[model samples]
Target: MSGRGRKIVWGLVLAFISFYAFLEHDVRGRFAARQSVEPAVIVPNKALAPVMAMGFHNLWADFSLLNAQVFFANPEYRGRIEKGMIFREMIELATTLDPSYKVAYFFGHFALSSYWNNWGVRQANEILKLGWKNNFDDYRFPQYIGFNYYLNSENKNEIVKWFRIALRYPEAPRRLIWTIDRMLRGADTTNHIHAESMCAMCEDAKEKEQKRYFCERCETYTALIALNDLRLAYLRDKGRPIGSLGDLTAAGYIDKIPVCPNGCNWLFTADGAITSSSLAESSTDVRGVP
Candidate 1:
């Protein structure tokens, strides 16, 4: 086959794999519902990956990335990832086994930071940090690292100091480890820094596709940030929590609910927390709480 033919073949192969995985999950989810049992998900022990790799670490990393992509699409199962069952572990396994897996780092950044309520900032930054350590020449990773820090404004000084320390000693294992520790500890909620990052990525990213992706992600982030900010404002002004996401619009805080760039709908709770169905399964906790 020609080089172009080979590229096309691999593209189809990956698409097929992703589609099959999605279908299998869909069928299994329905079956599990009928059977009244939990969907069986097998996640590897990230720490034991080296032993299990048995000289196929690179291949294992690729598989981990695929799994990460599949799981990231279903926010319902994100709890599994958050509760230490899948999402975060897969990213770690992929990057640790194959530190140069650039896509995994990028994928992790978006997947981990899907929560506007600050659920995945720590995980996203950790992935970004790992990428920065291994692929320091990539300015995008460092730029994003700084952007994620903007979410947690109170710890700005400490994060700035340690983040710079990490930048200075990218190759030092001990220092990088400590800096990552510091970065994870101090985050609050999302803010409207999305526009800045979005604009910066548009100007700096070389690829058109990548620029578009960042554009959508930033728009989504701005929506979430607005939701978080106005959620409080509604509480203070109305003397109660929002009755629904529409309440924000009804109250004139935002004109409309921003559809997620990921193509999944976002969810709102009465208490004002923002979660993404595109990032996780639609939340049931919201209805139960009220």
Candidate 2:
């Protein structure tokens, strides 16, 4: 191999490396370009306001990967690693890598929300902030904010406000918009029983003896619903005796709220066991309101 031959070979290698780099950069640029045109993508522009720009910036995405041991440590297992923690850190890191990655943001938000009940609210707010920073227009961010506020803060006003904002988005449905409006105006009828029944369905367990406990547990919610009806009746009549609850026919608040389709009697049992068993054997319609 003479010196000239080696020099020529080295030049050829350099040219190949340069071509490869150019191709790689071009492909990445095109991908980024496509992402930019996507409506869902939260791309940040240079013109963004300082505070908002912070949210859109890729700063905190890879918080865990950069700190390997901090993420891998699990005293519970000698050598076993905490995969959830590692995944969480990686997700955050990905978001940092690409602040515009709404998927990463959502994934991180969900993980955090699971770890902390109030996380949904915080994540919603964070995403909203990011959207605002990017001057991005989307209903999901605000909707989530409102949802978190309602679910975690119990702040009715805030929930209403955010949900209303969500309505402005083209994707938001009209029915939800109306419901939010009614709730905000306090025109929404309170159905304690229905709400309770749904909740019981969510938490009640079935261990044979405890089987159909949720179905029976609905009675409590039903009782509350009746109580709510009574309250409304007293309010509307403005002097009606509050001693007993009136039937739905007489209650002016709602016009025939949904009942359990199971044909199960929701009335109080003579023995007053106050169990969901009455409806359990009657083909529980799980979707029943009362």
Q: Identify the candidate with maximal TM-score.
A: 1
lDDT of 1 by residue, 124-174 (tens): 887888898899777567656665665645445444444443344334333
For residues 1-290, write the lDDT of model 2, one tens digit per residue: 99999999788666654543342233445466567731111222223322432342343233222332233243332222244434443554444456566665555455445444554446546654564454356566676666566557555556655654565566665455434433432322344423442344324332332324334435445654654555556656775433222343455654554443245444332322222333223333322224
Q: Name model 1 segments beyond 4 Å from true.
A: 1-31, 78-85, 158-290
lDDT of 2 at 105: 54
lDDT of 1: 0.62
C-alpha positional error of residue 183 in candidate 2 after TM-score superposition, expressed in Å: 9.0
Off by over 4 Å in 2: 1-93, 174-290
- Lowest-sum lDDT 10-residue window in model 1: 177-186
Q: What is the lDDT, from 0 to 100, of the residue 217 in candidate 1? A: 52
